[model samples]
Target chain A: MSQIFHPSTNTLSKVSIVSVVLLLGGLGYGLLALNRSPYVARTKIPFDQPVPFSHKHHVAGLGIDCRYCHTTVERTASAGMPTTETCMSCHSMIWTNAPMLEPVRQSWATGKSLEWTRVHDLPGFVYFNHSIHVNKGIGCASCHGRVDQMPLVHQENTLYMEWCLDCHRHPEKHIRPRDKVFEMAYQPPANQLELGAKLVKEYKVQKLTDCYTCHR
Target chain B: MKRLPWLLLIGGSMLMMGCRQDMHDQPRFRLNAATDLFGDRRAARPLVQGTVARGMLKTDTALWSGKVGNKNVDQFPFPITREVIERGRDRYNIFCSPCHGLTGHGDGMIVSRGLKKPPSYHTDALREQSVGHIYNVITNGNGSMMSYASRIPMRDRWAITAYVRVLQQSQNVKVSELTAEERRKLEGAQ
Candidate 1:
């Protein structure tokens, strides 16, 4: 009342209001950008497995089929991990004394499994089946990117709900011949949409939009 | 006004943190996790004795085990229809052809990659071996071969055996045994 307040107090209050609004707006945008970034989503971040199994060496260089190790991809809910037996089938003779494969040999000898870290993990609520996808003509490369090129495996797709829905809604765009499911180098033909449509009918693929299709 | 924005920011972050606990701390047993509620201390319960799961009752020994009275049967339990053979071909290509080779030559891609090369099915030893032996190998796994029983169902195992027979026959067909029409086709192709 007695000139205690500065003459510029009103201007200071106005500036404070403008700064607060700008800060909040920037915060929201930053959060969204970070959420969608590959860094946060863990795409292309190679995980350290117990054994440094290289998809590049096995699948690309040696030309081993995906089904050789992932034996249950076409028949089970999960693409089963290879047993120690599967690894030793070759390693027993090929790289018997390689220090890198000592863990594999130990696991085989002790009958204990190597604890390989999983890369593409979905949340508990989400339900995904490798067999259904493979049997319905989804090529390994469609969702996994060029795994044959990666020396160490990494998550290629965001694996977010929105990412799944994109393919689920327009599955024809992703579908390939069933024979090509394991083909790492498969590419969509010029008439992919047409081929996809034909396959959708032939494979009887349900265009599932309900939450239960995946969530349950 | 300055105090109000600071309070709002703190409250929003607190609210977000509160929501995290519900899903992450939900009561559930993870695979092979230990649990005190069970006597075995295993989260996974053992199947009750004599309780067979639905669609898993293996009453027909021949169909399920490819054997009759502890001896491997020479014949398939079911009729070898064309469709069954085709199904066998598909299953064989996926499962058996990896090691046995598409032509049963024991020269599958794996063999070239330096895994042990299995004996060729075209060899007289394997050609004369009973179909049941092939089926037994698939079900129980032979030396250096992993058992495919878990990966391939019993019916598909039979189908694969049938396809292996087809492969063996393809490689060892006699010119005199060929039908007149088949002989003509072979001559023309040659």
Candidate 2:
């Protein structure tokens, strides 16, 4: 042995043990942080669009109905995006010369569509239908949040699988009268559970937990 | 040998991150993205000739087209029920009420904001027109109005036509022709 190793070697081994433990703890935290990050969840982050259309100004300020622009929500699978014709139907007269609306004006003039960036984008495999949800008395505010309050639209909820399952498992907590679907300020009454049960039956909402329901 | 387990743990975590690429960057086509698989270089395939999609046969001329031959049918293809009228009211309020107003006065919120004014349903011109004529306008559109054929189904279009007639009658009713029950209600309000 002849004193070949330094006396500090004993302390060095102890330090290495502590470092290994800390590294494992850091990895666990990093995974948790990534899941909650804005990149993955995308809640409350306004995405950039070709035009900065404000839902607040149109919906809250002017009292325009959501169906006024998203015209096919009640009838089709997709809540159809407004065409240039829809924008020009109002902007052609009102705000005709505003520089802020230049992209809208150009789209109208060229007969080209404004490439709007989608906010609440689901993965390709998710089979979400706007008509089924809307026709079943699920209000616009149920998933979209208070869109009328947002100056620029943003995804308000996590829109995760767990979040959707929470509502699907207990739809009575969320269901409302069909007439109130567009009402952004609608609140579930004190007897919401009773009302929801009645609506769940009336709308024939089945408890959808099968993987094929959403995945297919 | 002591450091080997530590290195393996770090490498394993890194490998887990790489595995996420398969689901996120899946082998699939974006909507309307260009593809070389087809001669047209489009990802979407054109419908085959003589192939009809489900529920889109359009064989019923009066039901689907609002016409029998060249003329618009004077009556609804199906009987107009109370439930049908309510559905029509809902659809009309969502679609037509933006331009035609809830009462078909052509003074909708859009018109107040400066879109072209539609003709009032109570006008002599519109009131005298056949039910088919009104349905034709809704199916094909007329003047500044855009065709709602795609947005509204055939049954709903008929329902809306029925509701529009009800609106016209409401505004153009004669007091003398009112039933005794209706007259009593009107006098009670006074």
Candidate 3:
């Protein structure tokens, strides 16, 4: 049994132990990075639609109010997608023959839905209501970002529980005046935290972090 | 038996590498999501023909139809308050001002972009028209104007009608109607 293991074997065993620890740590870090990446979080990635609709042209160029198209946003659970009639309301006259708007014309002619791709998709378990947020001093820009600037809309934030918790835990960081909820270019004022604190009380926004608040 | 635990460890971890989305996307049709139950694949079914929801009977000829006995009434169904005028102004800016213009001048952004320009709201003919007539025009299409009934609710339509009157009064104000301060400001600007 003498000299079954060489002197170098002792160094090899110690290095092997250290290498295993390093490998596991690297694996854990990679998983977390992957979890928050664009692949999983779907942030900053634009989706393909049947027709490329430009929010920039419609919202910023035309100065149309969000409520003009999303009519039920203030009262409904989901912010309503505009109907074909809403599209044709203007396109019927203005962009009558634009090749890009042919799908809209066809949808109007056929009385069929345009099947606009949903941009903000949360998990089914999370029960988010647009009206409640809109009424509670949470501006549309707070979550949707500068939609007036995006030709093709993309998610601005990770729709992760941690991201949601960050806002729910401290809503005073983002709350705005109720009148400015639909205003796209609304900037948080210099005294944003102070104003938000006053608005949080006036709007009666509860720091609802209970699991059932969203899960149910 | 010794190798079975190692095999289970590797297999269990491998399965979890790709997180299951079944929980994320539960088996339910979300709003506007596609469905196979209908020919159109629309989960939101259209209202059955002639089916009226509760409190939506809409039998008031004056309020809902903007007509009484086949004539556009001259009176507003509800009294126009200052708050109502403000609400009307807000709603008017959103939906009507696109084509009607901010000051009822029929020179809105859309009109500039080549939609048939609507008539100015300050004309004597329009000034004499009843509020109900304007309400009727909004409810039903008039000329190139599409029916806004689907977009504006009944109350909002009246509010907008009231606001249209405000715009009319604002543009056609008589020189004598202005206060000394307002008269000076108007003359100074010119």
Candidate 4:
């Protein structure tokens, strides 16, 4: 009797086995890439807002300090969003008639809050504190990027556990002088590691890699 | 029929991988998050009228109101030190310098941008004004200036007031009061 299968059956079965493994591996990789993509993470993507607030104009041009509007950043867990009154503080005089600031005027007139789109919302479980970071010598530009240059704010870094751990593991790599924490154009000096090492010790920044550090 | 188990396994695994957001977005309100449950749609509720949180009752008329018995006090509630002055300088640069100018010349960037120029700190009227008066202006605002009470804390307002005094002194230093060494340094700049 003829063999149960053609002689080429051996090769076919062998090739199928390898191809199945390759296909599964590719799918796994694709899913991970998709998870980290801009679509999912919203990194570097600007969101539409009720008003076109420009950090570049306010921070770089007008030289307004971050704390001027985000008043509670240095003391509270949330970097407080400026109230409508904060906007009208300047807009009431400067851009009194600019149509671009109509929503601000409306909010001021109606006593309603402007619904600003959040840019750097982390997962709910992550217990991040801005005051601790700002007080511990982390410059605004370190994580927020050149906000002074961004016409519209966007997420400068991927809000990923791995990315956060990268800094939390070795905070010296990003630490700066406390005085320079709000400086938007701050640059790491030539002796960064040297200065950073000293600062890390002086600031007592712990390498908090434990799960509870962020998760709790 | 035999292949049904394999299909079910693959489909079940894909469904499981589709979502794990239960922990990522637990049912809780974050700061400033919008809510539909309230008529105002604000996650954060305004404090009720006359509601004072613990440790927030502002009873010190001198510190909170910058006045005692309806008169703005000339003395600060707390003693000023070098450290306090430095902190004042820091806070002043952030909140006050934008409209008041670094030298208190009333020509800050905001002034150039068309906001009414604030009065120079070196003006005789301002120089003679008590510290608490300035703090009151910051707390309650004056003329076109809006109230900064919500922006600057009580201690920081006093600190800024102290720094404003320093700026006034800096710009109005008497030439004869300069020491020989300081006068030489000033002359060398020219």
In terms of DockQ, the best-performing candidate is 4
> Could you give candidate 1's per-residue lDDT for residues A6-112 as a string of tens digits?
88998999999999999999999999889878898889899998889899998888776787678778887878878787786568767788899999998888765
Least well predicted 10-residue stretch by lDDT in candidate 2 chain B: B24-33
Give stretches of model 4 more than 4 Å off.
A1-27, B1-17
> Which sections of candidate 1 miss by over 4 Å?
A1-31, B1-9, B15-51
* Model 2 ranges with Cα > 4 A deviation: A1-34, A37-39, A88-112, B1-19, B30-59
Candidate 3: deviation at residue A35, Å?
1.1
Better of 3 and 4 by lDDT: 4
| Candidate 3 local lDDT, B98-143, one digit each (tens) | 8889999998888888888899998999999999999999888787
lDDT of 2 by residue, A91-176 (tens): 76677888988999897787555667778767777778899999999999999999999988999888888889999999999999
Docking class of 1: acceptable
Please tell me which predicted candidate would have the highest TM-score against the true structure. 4
Put the candidates in DockQ order, highest first.
4, 3, 1, 2
* Per-prediction tally of clashes: 0, 0, 0, 0
The per-model DockQ list reads 0.27, 0.25, 0.65, 0.75
Show where candidate 3 strays beyond 4 Å.
Answer: A1-26, B1-18, B184-190
